[model samples]
Target chain A: MAHVVGPEVVKYACTCGLLKSISSLYFCRYCCQLRCGFCVCHEVDSHFCGKCCENLPSSEARLKKNRCGNCYICPSCQQELSTRIGSKGPSNPEDPKSTPKKMYYLSCLYCRWSSRDVGIPDQSAATGGWPDRENVNANRLQEIIEMYKAMVLAEKQQKEKDKKKQRGKYLSYTDRTGVTAAALRKRIGLPVDIQHSLLKAKPKEPEPAIAKEDVEDLPEELLTKPVNLTEVTTIEQRLLQIDLQPTTVEKLFPVHKQLSIKRSLRCRSCEHNVSKPEYNPNSVKFKIQLFAYYHVPEIRIVTVEPLRAGRPSELIIKFTNPTQHQTTITILSLVLSGDENEVKEETGDQPSLPQEKQPPSLSSQPSSLLSLSSRQPSITIKPRPVSQEVNADVAIPSSKVILPPRDDAAEYDDSGDTHNIQDDPKLVVWRKSNKAFVKLLVTPKQGLALNTEIVAGFTMQHIYTNTIATTVENREPDKHDHNIRVFLTLGNLVGFD
Target chain B: MSRNSIKILQGALVCEESKLRGDITIGTGTIIHPSATILAEAGPIIIGDCCLIEEQVKIIHRLPFDQQDKENTPVLIIGSHNVFEVDCHVEAPKIGNYNVFESKSFVGNKVTVTNGCIIGAGCKVTQEQILKENVIIYGHDCHMREGLDRPGLQTLQMETLSKMLPNYHHIRKPNKKN
Candidate 1:
């Protein structure tokens, strides 16, 4: 429940200043920075129908205007319409053995809306041949489109002719209109101007559309008859047919369900996909998942004492190491003012690579860049300073807490403590496999009002083990101290009786 | 509350363990589970034919607050083909034919239920309103939708329950001969 529907008491500050739960954040291994949905580039991976789960190619999806061809939704209720079979009387009633012909029609189970209500004929076959509504002004619209195409082509040819004129060593009079060149040739006693029979004729141009002042009068029956709301279409029902927007229920028709797309999120800075789903829609698996819950240490508030003004309260927080490698966590004072950051300092100190946040060093940079050449260059959003105000001051412990790597076998075993390790009695309250509960003292700001919300923040530095080999010689994983600012909403302050 | 008077008609299958109070009449082809409770507080509860009263179902025949002072005893008449699912509480004044009270649902005394209505699972409806035929009350918000046809009857489920129930538990013999 805490992983899904639990209240977000602990929030980790993302690179974009927004505080999000660790479950929603992505940890980019290359940049070693936490990225949220706001600071990532989302690209569509595939398009598929939600109902049929039939995957459509990008080109085919574009041709169908991103709507599923086979499946349709009810115009009234916006639910998927199922094909129901209707029995029609056999034409050959004289024969006793003939079975009744079956016809298929669309019907909505929830609302009991049938296609016959809108005068749609039942189809003999199931899949295709449903009549598409022809636009009333199709011919006129076609003429207008043709006229614009010709006009644009004519303008392009004229521009090319002007460029040729600039390159001419000797200017000719015929270049002005072509009539001047032909008339000049006729005046010079040239035999009737030999002409190329295959020359194209002048492009056709249609008349411009004119606005009409006349409007259709309202129907007389609307004023006389009592209107039934159910008979009239609702706003949502009308909006389903974006182009038509039919007002009457009679005009409503079944709409093809819109296609859903599977999107892959890429880290804005390093151009690496943080999360990518499997190609099949049915598979609930991911190809690459860099969720912060999996990579970073998950901090959960176990319990906190009653908060009072200027009083030190005991706060116990449990930290779970989800990664395969063991890491040490040190509680640091949160630097709310972004004047100095630990990430920038770590990059500056490294003598091998001077570039900051660019982890694809000499070994793995070239191939990744080549594959992403077709995609647009992702814009690097600037990191914003953490905005959460720490109203309560936390007593930072000098001692670092070490957590064991996650083990699947240890989770099932209910036996007593197998690995005995020395822990600081003052800070570490409890310890188990890959998890440790640490104690901290928190004091609300002095002269705080009664029942004021107390928010406390602290910077946690954990050594992150990068398993990705940056060089050929690097067989052992390189560990770097990654800093994450976590804020806890420790409820409202209470008054001392 | 009066002394228990349960009248089981012909072809009715009622478990002996069921709690029946104050002049309750169960009609033909009805199946009553062992743990169902039917309380007739102010009047007699006349349940019609082919009604399924599952376990933990409470059917109370108590009058509403406004109508409680009146001396006239209103007979709570449940029409034919009604289903009272497990853990549902029904105190409706009138229930027409082919109505389904789903599991854990509560139908207050003020709501008048007509024919072919379905009160969805876990839905609590207390407001005074008449439910029309083929009306379905569903979801957390109790959204209403009018279905074109009545919800299909649970004939197959009732048949299975009737055959399987007699094997496991003691059934009350139908007392009414005619």
Candidate 2:
């Protein structure tokens, strides 16, 4: 019988194949390979002070003359020098604070000798905390200003050139350009000298207008024929009553796209990079920084339905999760406001009907496997007030559910999978708790029609209570009455109906 | 705007040939000039309120930086009663009053000179550097660069002055005029 043995399989072909933990793998800086410390050449960059790294913001770091403002490069070995607290060790004993307490890796690019071997002291190491440079000279300062001025002048000249080029493209649109030029000059408050140059009369050009037949003609069906939306209208009519049911009105349209990670390589000499290198392919063990927008699942319902009897109506929302995973949800109070509807309905307004979407049914598994949990964990959240007004849609996952993976998905273990979809249909159940009463009364006028023209738009929880006079003769019952209540489910909510 | 006028874009004052009051201290290297008005109505113009203002050489506080947006308005605080000599300009300080300005001083944009400090003649303070209270500055444009590349050559002259006047301290008293 032919031996069915695989050709001499390597036992420890990359610790990746072995049963070893991730920590055992050593990162190689130069080769960008992950070895078990035995496979590849490991080179260390400059050692930086831990304290400085923690304190400095990224913006400030980029502005520094050196790539690192606090950490210094070792002039002798080209290796990073480690900073140590207290006097003693390889630093000046006279200056007690200048010493290396811990051993950090450094590489000599020329010799390929790591800091582990040659004990050469790096000059870039912070021996005395901070260095004092001499004061700036007045002449150099003036030169910097002059250079900045020249750069600004060059930028202005380039903008002018671009404007002239744009003008060349549409020479026949001289009248429009004249108007735009006048408007721009007025808006920017340009002085008289520039205005004179701008408003100078130029020769006008007349161009032949294209006939209707010259333009690209569309199909007759696409042009004047109307779409037969009877099916949509009937479905919309059937669902109109369901919209009247009280529910949370928080709705948002999320433009969902895949969260992908891109890796790039950066050179120490020039802070710029040629291409993004793969993180997994590189043996460089960089500190992974993860930023996430963690939300506390909550729902809100806003309505304009006036409460005449000094009583608030209850809001009822139903959400169904199609996925088998159990999720958490929270209910939040809603803000209600009143406003007039000024949007006029177009004659051929074929209200787009929503396609019948199926609810995700739960598996036949026992309910004992899942339990209710808080949407937000009991962690203190310090609300950092943003200086500007922001319109942001935050997805608040339940404490039980997981947050979705971001672009840099490798950084975080976002195990919650349901959140990555538009309809992870959650069943949110809540009751209206506000007791604020609002009153609306319509008084008639002499010159107007017998009945006042009243229109109303409502959401899932909001009910339109517009007073209608029975005297209006030419009103269609289906069109004049409130047609539908819109149900909006936000990403942050658990269940929505 | 002209280059010189552009320099005054970020809340700078030019005394425009005026006198400054006393008891105000300014940050190091502020510039104020002639053809400026600094009238501290109520509070003294205290430079270096937040250490952001640079070069309060001959600056005065006729109006506050915030209140300068008001139309046809005269500011109440010309902090520290600070005065400027020829080519001395006055702009509003951050907060706190006390003016102490002296002759031929040129304060730059965004300069802060605190209360109880005196600025002396021909001084040109450019960038944002603090001048503490009771800090007395003397000489012309004390800020001078000390490097190999001296493009403008004016920095070299300033450096010479810095060397000539070696003794510098927060509490150093002004040397008597020769």
Candidate 3:
């Protein structure tokens, strides 16, 4: 647990070839592979305010520009402002029954900044109605937006007309013969018109802004007065009020707090959600979380002997089984990314994958499930190759360790191991209810310099007991071997004594 | 340097477990918690009224190395309504009213603190300069800003701590009468 602040000694290579801690990696039960944030598709599930926890619909969020209307942050320090109650003295000094009026003003506790500094008047009641400054350029901006909308609408109509012309099987009344429209009008005994309504219709473009050459010169007072840093607002304070980046302190205003969103991650291969958060903003639980820490055997480096080049050193690591099913763990030789062609081919160039792997036949799933959640096809990002180098060699033991099922009551039950399970004395150093410490030998390469960091890698194969009911008929859950690449970063080599 | 002379005026609550050495004067209604150290190596410290010195705070009055042989003993005078939060080290020569030295903050001997000044948590002020009134040094970048008013007083916190600390800890009696 100290590794939260200390160095990360153990890292698991994601199926996408990125090395991440097991806690950050997710296990897709349907795909039966480890997925990381890089490989998973992250989508916004809901938007909510961090302070008030008020959820906003996507349309409303877009309308409000993704900022919480009620909550404001201090422009000076970026901390949330607290509304302070100030009491004005009773209107009548002689009347004892009169209550003093309460006025509310936003104040920053950290920097002691308040709305009064910028000359904003205090409100009588708290929630809102503090005057919002109208944007000076709002009208012009609205006109420009309307002009663009009209132009785009006209373009779309022209495109549709062209499409209709292309769809026509025969020539039209004008295009078929060599007769002009003016001649046709004369033949019909009517006055010939010069312009056609459709031909003359066009959207008027707005006048473009012209570049000015003149620049304002510095004021004469700048030479005589000492520069006061306090009067001028810092870059951060100015940027907080994005629309109007005020240069002076008096122009600084409180900014509305931006909204936060919950994200749902889906696996690309099987198109199943790997992690989905609960909709409620206050609840910390997740609706569906297939984290690898719950499914895979977590490895932690316990201790390692001081390193010397070409000398064998003992390295002890602890493994914990988080699931309820007993599983067997085996250590195998590491296979680099390029060497595994089958794994690479399936994950990459999968745009037209007709037959999805791992899930019970895709046709067997309900049709409504597919139509209800149909969305635009997600773009697949290819994983990069693992770039970590292994400087040390690990002695892969032939024996396998059997981890017992996790029992909550066994924590208090002092009566130790009644179950008869065979253990390798050389490998198993210590064993608890569901945890075991395994020992191994590591040898750094001979050419390594002093103080060079040693890295050892291996592939771990564990029997994963799937608990998901894949089918109604098959009562027994499937058991399969899941392979994971484990890399350990041993400390720097001290010397070659 | 080994002399232990402490003068706690009336209404001042100075804990007996606090490490007080040399000549130190606590003003009326000032509260000093247990394990707070005030070492007067080169001079006496005069703490003013209603100041709060929390646990693990170290206020040392050691002069610079070059001025060790000077004849005059420099007096470290702290002003009223100040707050020295947990683990703050103040070696500053002068302190003014309504200033706050937040937790884990350090003030070097060269810097002078003034009224309504706040040294943010974990901020270190080692530069030699006089702090302006209401100047707040905040964040890891040590951003500076002038506040409109002094930060709210810790009257409620001090009232609760005063009532709570004596129940569990030993209090040093005030010998000096106001």
RMSD of each: 10.5, 36.8, 10.1
TM-score against truth, every candidate: 0.82, 0.17, 0.87
Real contacts retained, model 3: 0.47
TM, chain A, every candidate: 0.81, 0.18, 0.84
> Residue by residue across B1-178, what tens digits does model 1's lDDT show?
6488889999999999998999999999999999999999989999999999999999998888889899788999999999999999999999999999989999999999999998988889899989889877765666566555686689999999999999999999999975
TM-score of chain B of each: 0.98, 0.36, 0.97
Model 1 scores a C-alpha lDDT of: 0.82
CA deviation > 4 Å runs, candidate 2: A1-497, B1-58, B61-178
* Predicted structure with the largest DockQ when compared to the true one: 3
Consecutive 10-residue window with the lowest summed lDDT within model 3 chain B: B143-152
lDDT of each: 0.82, 0.30, 0.82
lDDT: the better of candidates 1 and 2: 1
Question: In model 3, how large is the Cα lDDT of residue A351?
Answer: 30
Q: How many clashes does each candidate structure show, in the order listed?
A: 0, 102, 0
- Candidate 3: stretches off by over 4 Å: A1-6, A91-97, A144-206, A220-226, A339-357, A361-377, B155-170
Off by over 4 Å in 1: A1-5, A84-229, A246-252, A339-377, A418-420, B17-19, B54-56, B84-88, B102-105, B120-124, B138-145
lDDT of 2 by residue, A327-390 (tens): 3223222112211120111111112211111000111113423421221112221212112211
